[model samples]
Target: MDWVRQNLGHLTRGQIFSIPTMTMIEEYVRRDNQFIAGPDQKYVCSSDDLAEFNIPQGISISTYDRSNVIKLYEHTVFRHALSYQSDSPRPDRLASVAEHKGKIVGIAGASEDSELMWQVGVDVLPEYQGLGIGKAIVGTLTKRIINEGIVPYYSTEVSNLQSRQLAISLGYKPAWIQLYAR
Candidate 1:
């Protein structure tokens, strides 16, 4: 144990030790982007396709935020998506949003990879709940992911039946339940 004891001081000083955590997330993001940006082989929702549906007035889709939208997004999607993290120094990639009269109603983000994993955050602002906005946004987002030739996947906690049902409605099946290594 002398060797361990001697190295403890050096190790505690934040000496560079090679590990996969940093590269893991980085590679994961890369794979996702490559997947999403791939050929539009699958069929995601298109602008023309959405036009057929009656998109309510005062609602707009974009990727902008005026307030602490980043924090809000991390909090919202993390409930279901185990991989949805709030780690510092986030990757600068996310999805568009659906706004209503200068307020956010729904949000979504897609990480680029061979198969893009997407999270569609539908926030009804307490007053706009159950107005089919969430469904429309998720549907639009999922269709886009599929069209990119990458399989679309969503994550939700087992207790979140409502979110899971929403994923099912969007034709997403249960991929797997992740067990973390504590």
Candidate 2:
């Protein structure tokens, strides 16, 4: 806490989480023998800026039932889209799954992070990436969340350019940054 006070005390909430500031914080924590988890960027789309997005051609997107979603939790490739932990306070609440030739190829899942916010995550099978699967599913789910009167947010590691691009393409803008120490 003292390190944060010394290094970030002067900055506004938004500025404190900038890349340069996080880099310095990471260095300081390393010297203190603690490890930084992420300098993750959080993105959000407002109801006004979030326009309707068309589902990609040949890809069918639909909501998954809770039981089916639980089965998907066992698949590691879908880790980003679904949380398997039974004890988690933010369990997966809704999912927009993409199907290609009757096989599930991508997913956009959401967790109710707070009363007014839902956090979305996406996963696309390796063979299906770059086909607009990620963007379509995430965009579909974001609109659904917004219609429900909740704001949807997405977060990705700073280095994950592809993931960040997917969010931006779906009308999300960087809203904040966060780093955790473990």
Candidate 3:
């Protein structure tokens, strides 16, 4: 089967380059560059922009409160789940954590040394599936992570259409393809 090369090394900032897909790449360039530049245009990609939910663990719902170190430790389950989707653990994971407003609802983090990058993770508190919260969280995380100078990357089992769709919805194209061998 034809497969794309997966390079953990980043091309720009923390951005990981997956094998480029012509269609998706074109879309990315167009959308990212099409933003209107007005004096009133607010930069909408910070971790602090989200205010719809109560702060979990004393931190804002989507904001990174590094002071609350304990909250950062709570994302291990999600970290493992996200890692499992890929063929291997992300070698440069710098931070990992889950966010909960009563229960775990989001997960995100960075890789190695780059701040501008794509961190991979997921959310959905069992009862929250199908509500678009997963998609929102991923969007929130993606924008926040990418804004930090890291290119976020993630993978899911080829069978997971929900996740695959979600990733595509957020502008993440497959960087590489993986086939498990016994």
Candidate 4:
């Protein structure tokens, strides 16, 4: 707990998600640019400009304050990658979505596992991936969590370098590594 305190900040008791407790997110991902990498941050963007940022052209993005729409994503396809549900009561979660032709092709979610730890999860459709959609949504969500004064962390399978790199590109450093049996 001491290490958590020294690195990640503390959360006062009885605190819930509220406007007063929230701080303004620095960049919510404007219409033009999606993942705006910070100064000296080489992991964030494949390119500086949105037009060249690698996302497939003619895509639309959105974010939600609730997880309701997560149910809309295909469960069979994304279930292994994303576990949270719009109606589940276990972990408190919210989501962001990227659409192509009005279909949800990508989603990024944040889950509050503990008062001080918020874990992030993301899923991009197999057909629509490799185009920077993962980084765009995840980076935006990370920034939004930072705006709320909470540090966001991630966990991915050892073989999933894409997932790991997405987090690293968003300015998250590996604090520790773990190897456990399922």
Candidate 5:
């Protein structure tokens, strides 16, 4: 659990964990932009402000409705964002789209993977990659979920460093990481 030891400070620090109902020990790590602890007490930790969550000005991001998702991504691979909505047993849904010059260039969507965790998936047009479009949409969508009191989680292939970095830049840490063959 070296990853947890090394990154626990970033996710949470200095907070006393006395909540007995916590099935997951890592859940005690809360996000406080200014979580400063006094001294090295029995239990204390900390995290740095790694990245700016806000996007550049002039780029707009907004949530889309069921019908709107199809119209927006019918021509793009992000069309998959709406696929589960039509499933017989579907997941909770929330999505945000990024636009430039009135064209949707990126989409960030969450499908509830568990009772308390919603998996985040972001897709950006090839031309828009690395311009922070993915981050903008993902950040916005994550905030929306948190506003509703749901945990937003991100998972990527171990080889996908860019995706991992983006998630970290937004303050997401490795809570439960594992690798398995398909």
Candidate 6:
């Protein structure tokens, strides 16, 4: 704790999570072959700052209840956008789906992380990747979450440029970073 206080306390939040700083912390504390994980980026957008996105010409976006969301849980391809963990404190509460030609092609789901905050995740089919489906569904869900008086947040691995860009394009700002042991 003293080491963390002295070495990391003085840095700003963004600086504390930089690669060099995280590497230094890892080197200082890692024990015999243990591995470290993360540097995941967390992003959040205020209701006033949320951006608008247009639904693609051939795609339709609609909200889905929990039961409908659960039907897609077995689909590994959409794992990032939807998960049903019975014991999780943060339970998934809402999903906005994008359908093309009557087939579900993309989904944006939100988990109620806390009373005032919800975390969002998204997945778009490989064939529909370049289209605006991800942005549109996420934007729709984000606005709905905000309307319910809760903050919407998103997180992604540091290496996922597309996911980061999607969040940024929706007007989400970096709130924090996490580095943890695995």
How badly does each model clash, as a count of residue pairs? 13, 0, 20, 0, 5, 0
Question: Candidate 6: where are CA atoms >4 Å away?
Answer: 10-15, 18-21, 24-34, 66-68
The TM-score, computed over Cα atoms with residue i paired to residue i, of candidate 1 is 0.50
Query: Which segments of candidate 5 are over 4 A away from where they belong?
Result: 1-51, 65-76, 79-85, 88-92, 180-182
Structure candidate 4, residue pairs in collision: none
- Tens digit per residue, CA lDDT, model 3, 16-125: 22334333344544555642111111112234433332223332344443344234554555552244222234332433333445555655444332344444556555
lDDT of 1 by residue, 115-170 (tens): 34433443444566566666566666556655555455555555666666666656
Off by over 4 Å in 2: 1-3, 11-34, 65-68
User: Which tens-of-lDDT digit does each residue in 31-101 have in candidate 4?
Assistant: 33544322121122222211212345777777765436456445445553355454555353556677889
Predictions in order: lDDT = 0.47, 0.84, 0.46, 0.58, 0.62, 0.86
Q: In terms of lDDT, which candidate is strongest?
A: 6
User: What is the alpha-carbon lDDT for the whole of candidate 6?
Assistant: 0.86
Over the stretch 1-182, how does candidate 5's per-residue lDDT look in tens digits? 67446644445332323233222333333332223222111110112322457775667988864445444435457843434444424453778888898887888877767767777777888888888888888888777777666677777755677877778778776765442211
Q: In what order do the candidates fall by lDDT, top score first?
A: 6, 2, 5, 4, 1, 3
Model 5 weakest 10-residue run by lDDT: 37-46
- For candidate 5, what is the lDDT? 0.62
Model 3 TM-score? 0.48
**How high is each candidate's TM-score?**
0.50, 0.82, 0.48, 0.60, 0.63, 0.83
Candidate 4 wrong stretches, greater than 4 Å: 1-56, 67-76, 80-82, 85-90, 180-182
Judged by whole-model lDDT over C-alpha atoms, candidate 1 comes out at 0.47
The CA lDDT at 74 in model 4 is: 55
Q: Considering every candidate listed, which one attains the maximal TM-score?
A: 6
Tell me the TM-score of model 4.
0.60
Q: How do all the candidates rank in terms of TM-score, highest first?
A: 6, 2, 5, 4, 1, 3
| Pick by TM-score: 3 or 4, better one | 4
Output the lDDT of residue 67, model 4. 36
TM-score of 6: 0.83
